[model samples]
Target chain A: MAVVSGSAEQTVAHTPSTPATPGAPGQTIAIEVVNLVKRYPKATTNAVDGVSFSVPQGEIFGLLGPNGAGKTTTIGILTTFVRQTSGEARIMGIDVAADPMSAKQRIAVVPQQSNLDRSLKVREVLTFHAAYHGIPRAERNARADALLDELGLGDRKRDRINRYSGGMAQRLMIARALMHSPDVLFLDEPTNNLDPQSRLFLWERIQGLNARGLTILLTTHDMIEADQLCQRIAIMDHGKILALDTPAGLKTLIPGGVSLELRVRHAREQPADGASPLLAALRALHGVSKVDETGSDEQDTSGEVTFYRLFAPDAGALIGPATQAVLAQGAELRDLHLARPSLEDVFIYLTGRNLR
Target chain B: MATTTSPTASNLADVAQSTPPTLSLIGGAPRPKHSRLGLILIAFLAIFRRDLAVTAREFIAFLIQVLVQPLFLLFIFGKVLPEIGAAQAGFGAILLPGVVALTVVLTAMQGVTLPLVLDLGFGREIDDRLLAPLPVALVAVEKVLFAAIRGLVAGAVIFPLAWWILGSDYTVRTDRIGMLIGIMVLTALAGAALGLTIGVLIKPEQIGLMFSLIMTPLLFTGCTYYPWASLGSIKWFQILTLFNPLTYGSEGLRYAMTPPQHATVYGHTVTFAISTLATQWIYLGLGGTVVAFFILGVWLFSRRVVS
Candidate 1:
């Protein structure tokens, strides 16, 4: 469980300190969720079980996992839309369950689905949301107009939400969530069903928001999205976080930091030995960490080719030595490639399965 | 994308030095401008205004739904019966208050309850409203209040229509205008409260069952067609109908709109109780039902929506 002292602005609602005022960059915690658990009625297991993490101010934090992995439930608990079965969540240092109104005042949620009111025009959604946060009429209008322009929805301000496409509706949700200028923005799978073009557009917008110092907690099953956007990620599965680190740091958890693969043809037939001499020669190379052989009996009509995988801490430096060692063993190398471990490799390494 | 300076960011920074940039950039900035209560009131009005706008846009459908049943009832009891000599000349006057009462209760119930069920069920549009920074129970009350106001409007539409269509068969005495207004207000409130309670309690699939089992019985036994005093001959029905909140609403409107002598005059025909005592009891019953159901609705609604 991560615990932090409540900020003065949060403790005192009417204080001069506002939620949006920038604190010293890393000193304040935007969201602190402690040992959170949420179990539905008659359900045998908790949807989110003993999950704990903290998102620092101005960071793009991610909860990455497959579907039904409790990512949405955790977001729901943090945003005060759903209560936790047990444990605590604090938004901007205010306890979510004990004082949900204060917690709500400090955060906004863009849920997985488009929860916008279809009856209202695009601008009305933002205006009404601002009004709910107690913004005056003129200020709300200005904010609504500004937000619509910011989100690239200015031309469609008068359009009803029912007419909006999936991507447009999602942008509207984000615009609406931003209307109150919440300190912490919870986006649960914001780009789940978007086309590639819209998804890239949203990614840029999200990066801009984070650059402006918004504390963003987003959930996604897309490893590439998490790697590209999140400053730090908690890889979760089965309602528990399996790993937590930066994308690069997580990739290091693989047995070998990089994998080097070589397809070779023997220069001459070798005398029978317990193990292939080429494997032993590659393992003896200076920078090589581990060696793996893929046995393939079938070969092209011209010659028999064997594949060898060499694990190395620094595959770039070992390339010359590895190729030389293969040549000294009288093997002709057909192809050679160095592959750095990716986030997907890290996920598979940790979970023993690919992210669905 | 073009870079534009955030207006809220600058204004919020001026108001509070410690305000986070995220807050200022996303929303203008939070200041000590409004008290906690004031903020709550603003949120309440925001939600109320949203519902009002939606109801206004669908005003034609609302009018048709609210007016149809009452119009048919008035046409039958007030127009057809008297013309065909199947009922007394003044019978339309006796049924007039009941028609208004029925309209208020049914309209209010349907206005609030059906939408609530839909909001909580398939639509889930209520989730957006629930996200507002107010107590969950207060939001539930706002729904009831909005529905109550709509109920009053339904009554307004029905009253003149009932009078005009019922023709000379009915006469509404304005001697106790204050009492008449008070009764109408109380009836609207009671109707809204009841609707809220039922809306929160029933499953979406049970909406049809609610009309068949609960609404149909309440309407028939609510004295919409005749006086409660006239039900004395059927002793079991009088006892059974005390459970229906609409009965008190209809009776209260009957006492307020009809001539006072009619109570005793009608009493002679059915062995009715003292007029003043009956009227006071109806008032207390309506008020009590409103308070009870309002509290229950808030509690249940908050529990359901929040969880």
Candidate 2:
């Protein structure tokens, strides 16, 4: 998890500070959720419990989480696809429960699964969607053309949807969602099944859309993708947000620790009866936080190897003394490495488990 | 990297900042007209167009089964087998209308059942429409409309084949053109209404069971193969036939096309009259409309699951 800094807004029922108003021309909040709670009947756990979040206008917001984390459920409630068991969800200051049409008018949702008609050509898909929204015929033509050109799908406009490649299909899905020129676009796992290259391409396009003043709400299971694209992220699991902040703020929760790994030969043999001078001296170091032995069961031609995993506030402060202690004990250090607390490490710290 | 802030304060700040916006767009502004009927119409047209496109793609199957199924049945039931037994006695006169009515009913049922079940169960395409900013009633209406179109096509597709198979010896009632059209429309609507009801009641996986349990029995018992009066010898069977809507639809079509029908009603012998045809049409039209509403009612019950 990349650390994130969230820009907070004090919102009343419908008052979001927007640059669209006087004094501030570009500062506007797009989405807000307050004390959201949704439960499915017969299910033992709540899909979302007391969840809350907000998005600023014209920025890309990411909902990052592992599977079964209620990311999709949150989006569904916001989009009015499912009713919230109890909560307040609003889009662009519109209460979704009170007046869904107004909320829908300002937002478009792209579902995780592909639902395009296989028999219709790509162009027909846009035309049909536009019609469904009650867009006038003449305006639909112009909007469809502009969107197709902008998405670089103009040439393949008339090809049947079944014939489009995965990338093309994904692009068309985005284009279809954009047909209404919505202010906020909700994407549910937009790049779930795409190749790495295709995912990157779509990411660039998403960023471009955000830059052009379209607020985006996206959910993803890919940590690197979130780290690279989202300025803020919410780590969710089991229907609740475990942590929400800037990626850096999240990493800071790891407690100023540097992970140092040292590989040694004859690892199974505890250094001199499990209290070799090397181990005793390293334990006496001032800057080191904690240390543990870690390794897989498999061993190479060399009998058994072991790795010393250390967590320290300052690697530089402890490395010299620790290395000297190991050499004095007549231990052979095969390799040594130092790494800062990464997003994955933060996830592990927050959830007590690794992110897949 | 260290802010040195307490966890409680940080959480409070995060919660305050990330709250969602309110659910209403404007205060006292007029709302958009998101009519349930209008949304249903759009969904209906989309399904109809998609089905037509798919049907177009399988032109060979359509030609063989749709265009030829009734024609082949006409030959075997009206001409070939009739020559060997009592099947030929007024069979052409009766069977043509019977097969056409059957074709209309089958097409209508298929129009409603196959797609509705597939979208609701197998394909899950209904999710796309259900997510629209509209009520579930609109979705149900669309399914009925698509079925109506299919029924119309099925009724019309048989005319040319009937012209060729039965030839000029047919009564060829051009004068009853208006009545024929009326009967055709009613039959289609009744079939579609019943089909929609079944579509909503059963899951896609139970389609085969539905065919075997409901449709097959309905067809066999209804007065499709014989006139109601002809089944007088089987007195109880005649009384049971009235319960099947298809019997009324089929009888109405036969009265409109055939010169006359040797039939009975309410355990009494009667003659086929202009009023008899008109009454049957009226009955079917009313029954179909009621049934359509009933289907909509059933659909309202299961809307959440299908959606």
- Residue B93 of model 1, lDDT score: 74
Segments of candidate 2 deviating more than 4 angstroms: A1-27, A257-338, A354-356, B1-65, B126-128, B131-134, B172-179, B261-294, B297-302, B305-307
Report model 2's TM-score to 2 decimal places: 0.75
Clashing pairs in 1: A20-B19, A20-B20, A20-B21, A20-B23, A21-B19, A21-B20, A22-B19, A22-B20, A22-B21, A181-B27
- Per-residue lDDT of candidate 1, residues A80-177 (tens digit): 77899999898777888988887777788887888787767788888888888887888788877877887889998888788998899999999888
Over the stretch B179-217, how does candidate 1's per-residue lDDT look in tens digits? 877877888888888998898888899999999997989
Question: Could you say which candidate leads in TM-score?
Answer: 1
True-contact fraction per candidate equals 0.42, 0.06
Q: For model 2, state the Cα shift of residue A65 in Å.
A: 3.2
Best-fitting candidate, scored by DockQ = 1
How many Å off is the CA of A60 in candidate 1? 1.5
Off by over 4 Å in 1: A1-26, A327-332, A340-345, A352-354, B1-24, B27-32, B260-277
Clashes of 2: 27
* TM-score for each candidate, following the candidate numbering: 0.88, 0.75
A314-348 in candidate 2: lDDT tens per residue?
A: 67666777677667766667888886677788888
